[model samples]
Target: SCHPECNGICAQNMDSTSCTDPQTQYCSPYEYNSTSQSCNFEPTCVDNCDLCYNTIECQDCSPGYYLTPSKLCSETCPTGYYPNGEVCEKCHSDCSECTGPSDSDCTACVDPKRTPVSGICECSEGYFENSGV
Candidate 1:
């Protein structure tokens, strides 16, 4: 038997008998409760998730978040940060952004004290360009 509104039921006429398809039904994000028989959404995934199968298991993430290799949604891994498997890590002290963990790997510098000369940041005016320092 389906609900009175028939919102979650698909009725098919065959040989004078009506058949209801259970798989055709869909539930909203807030109404996906596994224990409930009705098409209702339950809060299963982590916070800021657009879609998830259960608590702590995210299928899709909301905006400003990135889906990691482990399937977890993270907001910390922005443009200048690196994923250290669990969280976003800061690059070198001289770098505003970097490809690795060294000063030579810097993509850009914080400026004034250090300026980006090529791909790396060098000491600007009033400071000597020291290498291997």
Candidate 2:
């Protein structure tokens, strides 16, 4: 049975029901606790996550953060990865920071000898491009 206002019909199951505000008449999302037969107003999404299906599964990230492949939100991407839109993408092998995956897309170089020149990494002075290094 539901509250008097609901006329014995809850929007969801008896164990789980949406909460409505008496003053504003607004409905808020809630989680059901079957054991207690009560609703919890706790947020379902994790911190830094804007959209999520649950506490640990994020679908989108807040500003300044990105959504990882594992559905976690991270402030910064790991090495060899760069923030692209709401996710992190792989960087070129020679680039520590880049906007894209191509070699010419490098914003920063992994090796000190290689310097960013017009978005591409170039060997300094006498230094030569070595694949082994």
Candidate 3:
């Protein structure tokens, strides 16, 4: 039997009452509004999200964007973090930009007084390391 809300068309399983197909029936930008029992054209996903279950649950990102663990789409990773495939990974504390998580993977230094030397951030000639007092 078809769901009463869907009229004569079955949105999902014939025995079920909710619409789960967001691709065909509702398209990517629309979502099934259970309360109204209708498809609504809403911005239910993040800006750069290509696919999502809802605003807070992004499944994939659009081109030139990456998906964060928090289910958000980002164009670029924040400082102290680097892009790893489709996700952002934390960099070493001393690195402003790095290829990996280790300090030795540093491509840039967070401090102007320090410089990247052999993939590591080291104190420059006119600077000295602080004891963190």
- How does model 3 score by TM-score? 0.57
Residue 9 of candidate 1: its Cα lDDT?
A: 46
Candidate 3: lDDT of 115? 91
* lDDT of candidate 2 at residue 57, scale 0 to 100: 68
Query: Candidate 1 residues 1-133, lDDT tens each?
Result: 2232332443421111332544555443433333455655455567778875445556577777766545578876665656564445667787887766677777778665887666579887789855776
| lDDT, residue 93, candidate 1 | 80
Model 3 residue runs over 4 Å out of place are 1-32, 36-43, 68-71, 128-133
lDDT per residue for candidate 3 within 76-128, as digits (tens), equals 87767788888788899989988888999898998888899998999989888
Q: If ranked by lDDT, best first, what sequence of candidates would result?
A: 3, 2, 1
| Candidate 3: C-alpha lDDT | 0.70
What residue runs in model 1 are displaced by over 4 Å at the alpha carbon? 1-24, 28-35, 78-133
Query: Cα lDDT of model 1 overall?
Result: 0.58
Q: What is the C-alpha lDDT of each candidate?
A: 0.58, 0.66, 0.70
- As for TM-score, the candidate ahead, 1 or 2, is 2
Question: How far does residue 35 in candidate 1 sit from its true spot (Å)?
Answer: 4.1
Q: What is the lDDT of residue 12 in candidate 3?
A: 59
| Worst window of 10 by summed lDDT in candidate 2 | 19-28
